[model samples]
Target: MNQPTHPAGGDVQPQDPPAAYPPYQPPAMPPRPCGIKTWQIVSITIAGAVVAIVVIIIGVIALSGSMNRVAKEAKDYYDSKAEPYTNPAERKTYTNDTISFGYPSSLQEMSLEGWNYTVRKGTVSDRRVFGDKDMNYFVVYTQIKDDGHPAGMSKLQMKSEMSSLFDQAQSSGSGLTDVLRHEQLICQKHESNDFSDLTASTGEIADGTPVVSFHYVCDSRVENEDSKIETYQSTWYDHKGRLNTITVSANAKAKNKYGRDSINIPGLTARLR
Candidate 1:
């Protein structure tokens, strides 16, 4: 028993120094994939929805504004034609020692808004309208107003000079649109005396013969405005020693219904004193 100790080396020998712990290696982990997270995707979706809603609301407001503008335009057009003519006091007969014209107070005022209407420019020296609130219709009467004749110029000289001026007006290219571009033919060789008061002019009855200008002038609806063009058989013109013209005004739809003779312009001309 005393010798049992003899087998073990008097004291325990130290184990090899712990092997330096291998520099603390951590477990390898795989890299995360490169992309948006679920929360990020949800945020983007919400943002897109907000933008779409805003766009839709803006579109609706714009459409409403456009509709309102169209309505106002129609109302103004209608009022311009209807209101003034409504009151008996608003309309009056035109009379002069040499000529008298205008609708009788007894007759109801007419307008395209109410029904198709006709206004005969039927005067040698005047212009009028049935429903053209824009005053698109006009009559131009010219008589050698100083015909380029000098105080002492001979009759032949005066006539020659005047002729030159007249030609200038006929072919004036400075500010005139080529009428052929806007003119749409409706009638030709129309009867005269039907829409002219020229027969009563002081000089040559201006009505060289009975003929009316062709029907249908294509023009804008508003005064001094150049949009929304429509054509109607509401215009007439002739030279009876004087230039007579009757301009008709109506919307496109109305023109289809009313026609060029809605006002009996010819009858009006013949009726005027």
Candidate 2:
């Protein structure tokens, strides 16, 4: 039988239903290898950092302790080498017409030969010398007439006098050379005789005395010997209208048994009239 046609249109064939799609599924992933978890990794990193910090702290503590020990050992070594001040009672008194002072009994009376002096005199009146057995170190205490120099001279005057004296020594072929140090020293009485407590002068000394100090090196003058002699001197005018000088001479090759640059000026002045 012939099919009926629609008006002004050709017959349309039936379309198949839309093909069905499989349910959406993602590609399968490979299995993971057995390993530490994220939290475990974090814990291990923190533990390593803590251990490093602990090691640093221990190293610092050990270094600090070593430094402290070294410092203490240095101090102890110097302390042992230092000579203590002689007790007043145990000290021996040296008395002369012009001056009287206390000296360590360990020192014996010495001669004035080869001693260097800043204030030269035709003859040292009322002089006393004391020194060690080897004479490597000695102290000369001498007094001279004021020669018109005023007592308690100013620092300028003292310096001028020192220059003049050094000039004289140089002129006289005394072999003094190389003025290593020259200055005014302000000294005060201390409860102990330790000279390490000496302080620099702040223009004036409160209840203290001022003295001029000098240091120079001289030829040993020994036959065929190339050694030098080191000399330290201190000069001050006392109220007695006299010039007092204390000289310390040391052999360049010998150690400083007194462990001081100069004698205790303040202590000696206290005992001087």
Candidate 3:
């Protein structure tokens, strides 16, 4: 080893050369297992969504089938219950000068004077011929003389007139309030029919004379108490040019027993001469 001389010194100690070093390298990481690919994850998600959709569709189909079955069963039950009403042996004929019809023998003929609303000034005759055992249901037959009112009025005309009467009665403090719903309906005289199958429709009878129907619901003071009444009125002109009106009234409690849907308007009208 040679000694190096300093600028101001005679001899300097021998110096070691710069140390050599290896290139820099990062630390090694542990080996890892393969992870799921993005495509595989997406595919799995799509497959799950498809399965869910299929399940929902199947459930919907099953529910629809169940609902249909329940509806059919209900219809069959109602039809079976109404069989007696359709049988003539279970009913009695009620004939008067204005109209005639068959009513269930379970009901009895009642006095018209008890029905306060049926006593109109223009009415020629009024008869509350049939009522349920509890007096909750009433069928009134009425004839209106063509004094100033037009004969053979249309369904719309009848609806308007009846609505006016309702408004008047309410305004006059007749205890008729809250006219909830009112609508014109069709009246058909079927040759042979099932009461359960009869529903309120809007059209004219093809073979027989057309009849107008109106359905209304209101709150009235009956027997010194407030009550909800549902009334269905069917009107037509007789051969003598008088307006014949058949009114069916059902109180709230009686609705369950004699619902508007259960009344066979066509059957009753068919019995009218």
- TM-score, candidate 1, is 0.28
For candidate 1, list the clashing residue pairs, or say none.
118-263, 192-210, 192-211, 194-266, 206-240, 206-241, 207-240, 234-248
lDDT of 1 at 138: 22
- lDDT string for model 3 (101-168, tens) is 76656567766554444333365644455766455656666666754566555546645555554454
lDDT (Cα, 0-100) at 247 in candidate 1 = 31
- The reply for model 3, stretches above 4 Å from the true place, is 1-89, 117-123, 146-207, 223-226, 258-260, 264-266, 269-273
Error of 1 at 114 (Å): 26
- The segments of candidate 1 whose C-alpha lies over 4 angstroms from its true place after superposition are 1-209, 221-241, 253-260, 270-273
Model 1, 1-273: lDDT tens digits are 364334455775556877755778888999988988999999999999999999999999999999999999999998766625433223344432222234324233233242222222222244333433333232211111122223333334433433443343245343112121122211111223112211111111122223222233333434443333333221112222232333333344433333434323322231111
Best of the two (1, 3) by lDDT: 3
In the order shown, the candidates' Cα RMSDs to the true structure are 14.9, 18.5, 18.0
Off by over 4 Å in 2: 1-104, 111-123, 150-207, 221-226, 256-266, 271-273
TM-score of each: 0.28, 0.39, 0.42
Candidate 1, lDDT over the whole model:
0.35
Clashes of each: 8, 0, 0
Clashing pairs in 2: none
Better of 1 and 2 by lDDT: 2
lDDT of 2 by residue, 161-217 (tens): 655655544443323222221111111111112122122211212223345555444
